[model samples]
Target: MTESTGGIDMDEDSSGTVKKFAFINRKAPYGTVYALESLEVVLISAAFDQDVSLMFIDDGVYQIKKGQGTKGIGMKNFSPTYRALEGYDIEKLYVEKESLEERGLTEADLLVDVEVLSRADMAALMEEQDVILSF
Candidate 1:
């Protein structure tokens, strides 16, 4: 069994089982391509009926902040689409507590409800996932 220092046991082949995917997003919504790409990945994963979850760390938390107005930049604000994730069965969303504090944001600042996890807790949660994709 290959044991990861992250404490993840990757010994089992989960081919036929429901795949658990954790997407780690650590980029801002605009001024970069990470956020949009991450969203597309989420959509594609959901389309495959995989159990997908999103974890926003660092500046990525801003992607889901409420009242995003990008019309000034001639871009359609995609904040509202996060709410539509539930329709695709992509429900588990997480935000790192330290990241929120570093950026001076609170749970009230987000567009959707998210589970706030400590860095250690988040690491443990990541270890439980069958796959992790970071962007």
Candidate 2:
């Protein structure tokens, strides 16, 4: 009495697994569309259960600054939206140490807590990611 397996082995032809992604934001949130667009992508990735991370560099760090007041310009400050990321399980937020120092901002000034990494560390970390999206 021999038992036979009915399922075909599909793993042989699989192209590995879906890649972990790292999003590098290099622009400010307001006065441009990059920041908002990046945020949308992050949400979409989370929805798909993708392993995703966000890194703020250059002027992009300003996007998460606390106490942003855009009402005077008829625009609502969207900084608070970052706080919602945790609920989506997208908590790997990174801020470049040099960028923050250059802008004279401490982590306390940011709207959310983030892992601060030096440029060299960031570069190494980025290399480990399977995909990198920059905005």
Candidate 3:
């Protein structure tokens, strides 16, 4: 392992290289498995103790929207799972400001606190990551 930013360990894999992770969510909640699967992966990744960032754009912001109810659709609402992420040390959540405004949503509509970013800022943040996974 080599020295990392902020003095964290830069772990080497079988190939002897470290990678940063960025997860992008662009799908709405409950309609498909994307949202749920992303959450699962984020939790798992957090266990690795690596640098991880989650970005929500487009309809993806709905994954963390408050007041989610699926009783009428016969599905279990998993949005509450976002609340526990902080316990796992996964606090880097970025939501696109434009996306929220387009959907008529404000920061208060979200279930958890997130750093809202402009499109350009989000793009720059994504560019800083070594591995980007979109769901």
Estimate, for each residue in 15-130, the C-alpha lDDT of model 1 and write its tens digit.
45677778899999888888998898788878767778899999989899888999899876888889999888888999999999999999999999899999999889988987
After superposition, the stretches of candidate 2 with alpha carbons farther than 4 Å from their true spots are 1-18
**Model 2 reaches what TM-score against the true structure?**
0.86
Q: How many clashes in candidate 3?
A: 0
| Per-residue accuracy of model 2 over 1-135 as CA lDDT, tens digit each | 011112323375734455577888999877799999889888887876667889999999999999888878888677888999999999999999999999999999998989999999988888887667778
Per-model TM-score, in order, reads 0.86, 0.86, 0.86
Candidate 1 to truth, TM: 0.86
**Clashes per candidate (backbone, < 3 Å):** 0, 0, 0
The worst-scoring run of ten residues by lDDT in candidate 2 lies at: 1-10
lDDT of each: 0.85, 0.84, 0.87
Error of 2 at 24 (Å): 0.4
Model 1: which residue pairs collide? none
Arranged by lDDT, best first: 3, 1, 2
| Candidate 1 off by > 4 Å | 1-15
